[model samples]
Target: MADPMHDAPRASITGRALHVFAFPSLLIAACLTGFLPAAPAFAKKPPPPVLTAAAAAVPDSYSAAAAKEIFAEGGNAVDAAVAIAFTLAVTYPDAGNIGGGGFMTLYVDNKPYFLDYREVAPQGATKEMYLDDKGNVEPDASLVGYRAVGVPGTVDGMWEAQKRFGKLKWKQVLAPAIKYASDGFVVQPWLQKRHDYAARSFAGKTNFDVYFSGLKAGATFRQPELAETLKRIASDGGREFYEGRTADLISTAMYGHGLVSKQDLQRYHAVWRDPLTADWNGYQIVTAPPPSSGGVGLIQLLKMKADLKPAFDGVQLNSVPYIHLVSQMEDRVFADRQQYLGDPDSYKIPVAKLLDDSYLASRAAEVKADAAPGATGVKPGLGDTMPERAQTTHFSVVDQWGNAVSNTYTLNGPFGAGVVVDGAGFLLNDEMDDFVTKPGTTNQFGVTGDEVNTIAPGRRPLSSMAPTILLKDGNVALVIGTPGGSRIFTTIFQVMTDLFDFGMAPQDALAAMRFHHQLIPPTTIFYEPYAPITGDLADALKAKGYKLEGQPFNGDVQMVRVNGTTPEADSDPRGAGVGAVFPLSPSK
Candidate 1:
């Protein structure tokens, strides 16, 4: 009869902050003696030794710990996922949010579900709002300021998922997030870059400085305003964000500079859609559907690769031949995405034909291992046409009961529209830019689109968030997703191939080098720094008439591979996050 959430074990902010400067005296002595301090002096103390059946991997350590705590509190995979999603809003501000939207692909009790909480354009939104008199897309019009924000769906989406599937109470699932925002958490070193960028770009003009200007590494950064905002939602419900006091703040904040209104917030609702599921060899792949081009693109790319199996028989993972073949597939997939995918409610996408075998086979035949797609960008298979941040966050979860959740959410850009609601403390998403303001113009991620993704009243913009789950023989095989704007689907494809096809360990697969080509500029391929292309491989690719570029970072992928009963997990080292089998005490 006792309350469970309050009874859950959690480290207090002061207690958690103490570990930041652990062994302070020892550090001074070591400095005085000219001896380097040991690893324990700076590294975070390890969690308890108990092992739980539930597992989670997240893009931030604070959110990871929150998931562990929720598992220890007897929450199911859905509950833990809902908890982590909220926790990230407090700790990973660059992408996590209540003021943004995203997609969630869940597998519970052997049934698959996909939730589209993608932000929708305001009722006042218009296709020509961002175009100039000469028809040029205005600069920074959709990238910054208030007009860029869409009506957020994250809070409602998480709430809908929990209400339908989670075992824990809604308020109980949100307790950890509320506490973190009010009491604070030790800021990680990775936050500095985002904080500095927001400060430099917006500063006093947009209120970015009011919130994050004081953020420092290893400091106990607090968000009292966000804390209060979360408390209101906990006491009320997701509706608190849509129709209550929080809604007022959001509308007031956008009174002149933005388009979202109190009406838009009240009208916002999340959708539960059938996941796009396909059979690839023996494994079943499940992912996001239209509105988000990722699932269709991912399945098509995989199918094309399968159809052209003979073309890549002898190529290595990152070899020139393999890269060429993959790029060929990617170019086609991206082309299909622009022409055939969009918000399903508004536009009927050709999902069946896009992933049909006949279509895939025809697309595969065009892929030549010996050459690139040529100087001309590939055209969509439909009529020969088509058309999303690396600054997003993703997390994967699986509980002892076999329920798994692969969730990816974002603010459309780093720190979103770079403005905060005056009284409510969350950043609004720049998702309006996700739409093609003008046919040929690019958004923040440098991806273009056609009318299929053009802005319209209350229409959801197209996205590339591909939170996916792979299954073998009716059991969960892999729970994977990542945060990369245009690079999202391509990055996920690389990781999936490495983990499933190449037989690599979880960590190695996530840490492996990656390549991406989204067909916008079909002649160029981007590769990451690890095991980079330098010698013969680089030459071979160039000889194929493809230009090579080094992207210092790829995707921050979070994954959990089910190996028998054991959960093999790893978070991308590219970002500061943790991936481990959270020790769940049996006694709980």
Candidate 2:
């Protein structure tokens, strides 16, 4: 495999300072005096190099470049995001997928909207399907083979978002992806490593042989079949992919191995829901809501930290004291997650109560200032209610219209179920593994679950994918998200603190080392290797009775900061990606 940084194009960093364009004094006065009916919409203009209006950060350099092209062609954030989503399918097969599904958060005209397109359990799914005759959980039932798949929703979700907010034609937005798939792209070291890891699982699968045969590091990999499929989708719209020949091909393959049927494909629809918002340090944080535990869990963690303020103030960042305090709070919030968060459509979640200020204050009171709390018996904070993979991709986009998008999608595990449909040219998702086979049991990521996220027909599994936006004065300030199994939320939380509390730039924030402590098995603190929390910091944390393990890598985060009107972007250095900015003029 070729090294990602060595093989991929370097990101162009723009040094432009951001400045917000002010409304004319007369227009503001007229609106205030009721002289004008309403405020006029801001007209779209080409972004100037001095004031960047569009920026994108994707896990794959090709995808980022494609998204920037869409923006340069006068598309809005939604259009650019859709282009990124499709292009990723061609370039980053590990997680970028149409056969899997996830979530999206979009900000347009000062309003935030969420789209839940996470894959759903097939109609034939049952809570006990993964259990054996003795009622013991079948280890492989939900992790591998045909039985692991769920009905996919990516196509539906992308179509719905574009239909509502896209400025370019669907066909135009899809052209770049099709071209990449047909002409091929260079494989980076990261992708080669992914292929090596997934190779064993693909053994004896004919479709895998057809698409991945002879793949090598630094070599060109083309998918003419996928290109043809994209052509059909572009010409006929999503209907061709969902209910026409593509659906027929997928149904035929799935029915032979898994439980999905033609009806499942035809019935899938993307749902639009209100985003969850919380106030933090005078800024409003907005993200995906329930069925996804990311937003609520993040808010609860932030509130807990806010309540225990002076504790963090005295302790240096990434120090033993700071790591211990944050880990303690994480345990409490995650306890709440396992106890309450779930799909609201299947069962009601107490989102309002969990985020209540009073309840958070009570939870914060439990934090110990000097010592590490024992992991054994910590329980959820007292509240009346409530309520949620590592294989995923996240991209952040901001366009010339002040519209922004944060999208995170996944295949559940690396290469998903590792099964490709006979002629579909895509892999199926093992998202069913995301659900608990039995109460108190841990899934692939070692995260436990309860009834709230049990497998049921048509139910969307709980997810850690948290596509998020930060707003200041009702305008987008930041667009961020990441891909890492159970570590997604913690990664985002750390990045937020880096930007808001420590005041680091987006690039520096993403580059900083991070740690995670999921409350389920609370004894260990997972820290990224070579991060600041090493040597003395590591020793100090261990002395506090917590096990510290160094992870080679954590989450792959991609972010965009709207410094006033200028958009600045960065992709995690750990992955093969680029943060490309589109200039106002083509000549630049």
Candidate 3:
């Protein structure tokens, strides 16, 4: 017989033996006909989409596009953030730009750094700047006028960050903003509404006409003058704004507006300070320090909540007990903030005592979880008490090169007091009023600001809109911040809880309508979506003998969260832009 195993024909004695040895004839036939695919099924599944990461833009669409472009150009997170910051300065000038300043917390290469570029009081500033004839604190309107402008440090701050932390050259990073301002940028609905009210202030000025001429409510506005200014800065670096003719022009314009002096401009600098951090459940959060109570106060409140082993699993945010407890903690933190936080260089802060674990434990012990702590139930500082930026914009970026930036910028208010520097086409910030004119007077929050926050010549006032970053095991976990004045810190806190504690996606975390109880108002401000929880919470509070009222509470938060395993960028849906990734990968 020809060898059956070799090239012999199928009808062989040995083939019959082998088939019979392995299986019956029927089984062998089925294996050859149908079950073969399942028999060798060890192929591995393919991986998910290969997108490097995601990004998100908040507020301005143009600025968001600019950030994406920077990432596409091989820029890292820092570079993209710088580009976004500068672009916002031009496109979203009402909230961001060279005219005002803010703070930044960056997590790059497993470490964190704080950049304090908040506005500063001018050299000629006086403690009584916002005081009236009777030594009483003036109304907010009286304080936030032309005379309330400060010596801005935003340009200097961005330049400093770019020079030190940015990967792309200054000119390269600024190209998008220059194009947007010079060529033209369309005003959004919110900007249009704000402009309708502020147009008078812009129109009355001689230089304002040069830029505001073509700006209509809902129409595209061109700021060729601002574009030129940006171009000069891009080419010349910080010198163009701080030491050149443009600086002179800004100073003259400010002086004419009864605000600042040239000396204030010359003396302006962005302070580099250590960011405050608290170790919470193995994660380290870095936020703005003293003179701005955001970080310190937030940490304090978190510590208080931790004491309860707070598992408010089903408790809706707007629930009475939920709002009351959080507000109770908020009040205590604000009290400490008002009493102690200040320009540490100017005064010593008891940060050690204020943030002490035991101290917070004792403070948290004062709360009755099931009961409502009235405004009076919480004493100021000893136990309870209470409280609480600029037109603010925030952005975050992370690159393959391991660079990251979480920055928030601002113009004091929309269009910044509506005063453009003569011929400069840039708005001016009324940031000077951020300082407390009197120790025990009502702040913008309608609550008393602390004495430590009182105004002084050439002092930077405390602010509440803090931008922050968080690190876990030395890797970036979250880059987050917001754009509401007194609500910025509170909004960020809630989102952080959702991300870290609940593991929600950035978009979902931000979109979740929030409630804010500042401890000043015994009531909770509920967003429309939170209405469902209101009745239940109110009844709960009433049963607990707590008084409850309702109001509107809204906030805009934008953030980027990196996945623990793959370093993915998950941008907030509440925003319009995405975090840019270097060496772009296909979208997920």
User: In candidate 2, what are the lDDT values of residues 347-387, reduced to their tens digit?
Assistant: 87776767877777878888887554584577866543434
State each model's CA lDDT, in order.
0.80, 0.79, 0.65
TM-score of each: 0.89, 0.89, 0.82
lDDT for 162 in candidate 3 is 69
- Evaluate residue 114 in candidate 1 and report its C-alpha lDDT on the 0 to 100 scale: 77
Q: Give lDDT: candidate 2, residue 196.
A: 80
Best to worst by TM-score, what's the order?
Answer: 2, 1, 3
Query: Residue 220 of model 1: what lDDT?
Result: 93
Model 1: residue 451 alpha-carbon error in angstroms: 0.7
How well is each residue in 326-416 modelled by candidate 3, as lDDT tens digits? 7767767666765666766467666556777777888887766655456354555543322221066777665543445778777756667
Decreasing lDDT order of the candidates = 1, 2, 3
Cα TM-score of candidate 1: 0.89
Task: Give me the displacement of residue 565 in model 2, in angstroms.
Answer: 1.9
Give me the displacement of residue 267 in model 1, in angstroms. 0.8
Instruction: Please count the clashing residue pairs in each candidate, in the order shown.
Output: 8, 7, 13
